[model samples]
Target chain A: MLWNLPGIHVPADPLYPGAPPFLTNTFLLTIVGSILIIALMLFVGRNPKQVPGKLQNLVEWVFEQFLNLCEQVAGPERGRKFFPWVLTIFLFVLFANWWEVIPGIETIGFKSTDTALSPACAHVGSQGFLLFGQYSNCITPFFRPPSTDLNFTIALSIVTVVMTQVYGFVVLGFRLQIGRYLVFNQGIMGFIVGLFELLLEAMRLISLSFRLFGNLFAGDVLLVVISFISIGVGAIPFYFLEIFVGFIQAFVFAFLTLLFFTLGTTPHGHEAHEEEHLAETAHAEHERVASALAGAKLEEAHAQ
Target chain B: MAEHEPHNTQNSRGGGSNPYQGALVAFSLVGQVGLMISLGALLGVFAGLFVDSKLHTTPIATIIGLLLGLAAGIYGVFRLISTFRKAG
Candidate 1:
């Protein structure tokens, strides 16, 4: 995103002047986030170590956290199968979220050319910035965190929804896959469940997409507002806060994706089965109580 | 023992509470918004059809308009969904 961006040299806005194309702030952040993530993984996983070193250890620890998260939802066996997805999601989002925290990144943009050309950089015989490189930096793109982009978040959410369905197909056959959500072929109940199922899947997409987009976008907007009010120093504290929010949002997105994957594979509406279980359990308890009472009476009679 | 209550589920009941239930609710609200947006889009296309029909263009105009409106609605809905349903 840094390579291409929300720069003055380019259109000030990512969206076309009239069109609501994209919010550029988001696009650039996602790119930078992607680049950093790729670079970090390559660097950390560079050398294969039997004993292990700091880089290897850190990577391993990160994997350990991811694994535990997967296990919580997918369980021991299924989680391992689902590890790759969970890990990928965490890394992508984590990097995007964390990218904004690096200081000097957001503030460190070249002065706008218009501002420089007006009376600003034109200090009488300023000699036109002297160096050619100086002129280029005049409208350089600003580096912001990637998660801050709505496009990136939406893209991730879409991928998450797709995975849930794929897993559903994998675990439940094509027929059950239909049965799991639609139930239309069977009857009204199935149809209702199907509609509800459709709605639930839709919810996953919305929740996963909007939560990340809303949080990150809000953070960026807040930071922008703060910078305007108090200048660079004022936005300092918020930058740190953004980092924390990024971590949480990323974790939540990944975790929910994992949970949804688990649920999509399960069949629709079994509320009655649950009720039946409760009744059986209560009956068993009553039987035990009756048996105990009978034993007590027998014991008393024998003693007499 | 006190903390670990045996709140077990029935055999037919698939393990834990439906994992996607929360996702279902959240996605439903957003999806409904999307649905409404498409519905409005369809209304526009159909309104155009009414103009054609009023001019006495029978069957041809009506059929064309119906098909076009349906196509527009389906396209909008599918497009919105496709973005959110890419492969993992």
Candidate 2:
């Protein structure tokens, strides 16, 4: 069953004319997603029971897992400080990305006669859907995943990087944090190194934003292509894959946020101490593995 | 069998880290290292071009920027790998 798919466009389609250029499908979804998240959190948290219901149980489970992770990664004090920011990012991105799998997200839209935007024929197919054989290419979807939009991802990344810098200054104070980027005390090579550090920070922003955008956009295209090739059945596997991708991307984003927060807040002297701690941890792990292996060997010899 | 207790307390996993944490860190770092190098070079080239426009030294600044960016990216990769190595 061949279906005419809309031309895959990089930019999000505006929902209506004269509604301001920023009122694209992705923007609409962003607002809706934010409200949904806030409402869900409030409803679940408003009345707490000694014994939680299914909804509350799920919410609490997610929170506990992430809270543990934050504490483990950034230590108790800083992790507690950074928990809310990390959790908010994880939840928002997770839901926003999960929107892709919803039925009629890209399919349900008005057939536009605007030839400039949608040049295909406006005629609906006999099946009564706008995206029929020749008519499918012109439908402007009312809902698109916010993650697929560069604007949304870039804006989110800007917030993340800026907040990281803010945390750095807050925790490390002006002199130490500013010294990270501008090393005037040392000679020209140190100055050059500082410039490189500044450039690397810019690179972090670009990488963070584009990594998310590229993955989600590619996943969106993959789903469309798979569906186009093998009706609906072939798309099932891809749907599951997309779901997994959505979760993973959200997780990676959150983890990166937490990491950046940790790095930004940590002073240079503290970083050296952390490295020493890490070395100690590695040494301990090696000893534990060696002992386990030795015990396993002894058991095998005894059995033989 | 005794019923498992709910982990109501933090750091109650007997000092054992989350299994998924290592995997995720590795996954993210793989993407991160490659991206840092490529984007570093790209940012360098763009900055060079901008300077070239003002200074009227077209290719010279661009070349210098490209080299510096490449070096910075390599340094960054090494730094990341060392950190990972120590942690592991």
TM-score of each: 0.59, 0.83
Q: Candidate 2 lDDT, tens digit per residue, A1-304?
A: 2456556989998988566889999999999999999999999989988999999989987887778767766778887888999999999999889999998888778766656544445333233543555565667789999999999999988899999999888888998889878888778877887787777677778887888899999999998888877876799988999999999999889988887787677665345679779999999999999999999999999999
TM-score of 2: 0.83
The best candidate by DockQ is 2
lDDT of 1: 0.61
| DockQ of predicted model 2 | 0.39
Model 1 iRMSD vs. native:
11.3
Q: Model 1: which docking level applies?
A: incorrect
lDDT of 1 at A132: 32
DockQ of each: 0.05, 0.39
Pick out the ten consecutive residues of candidate 2 chain A with the lowest summed lDDT.
Answer: A118-127
lDDT of 2: 0.81
User: Candidate 1 lDDT, tens digit per residue, B1-88?
Assistant: 5885556432112233344533542454364446434553455456657877798765567666555445544543443343234211
Instruction: Count clashing residue pairs in model 1.
Output: 11
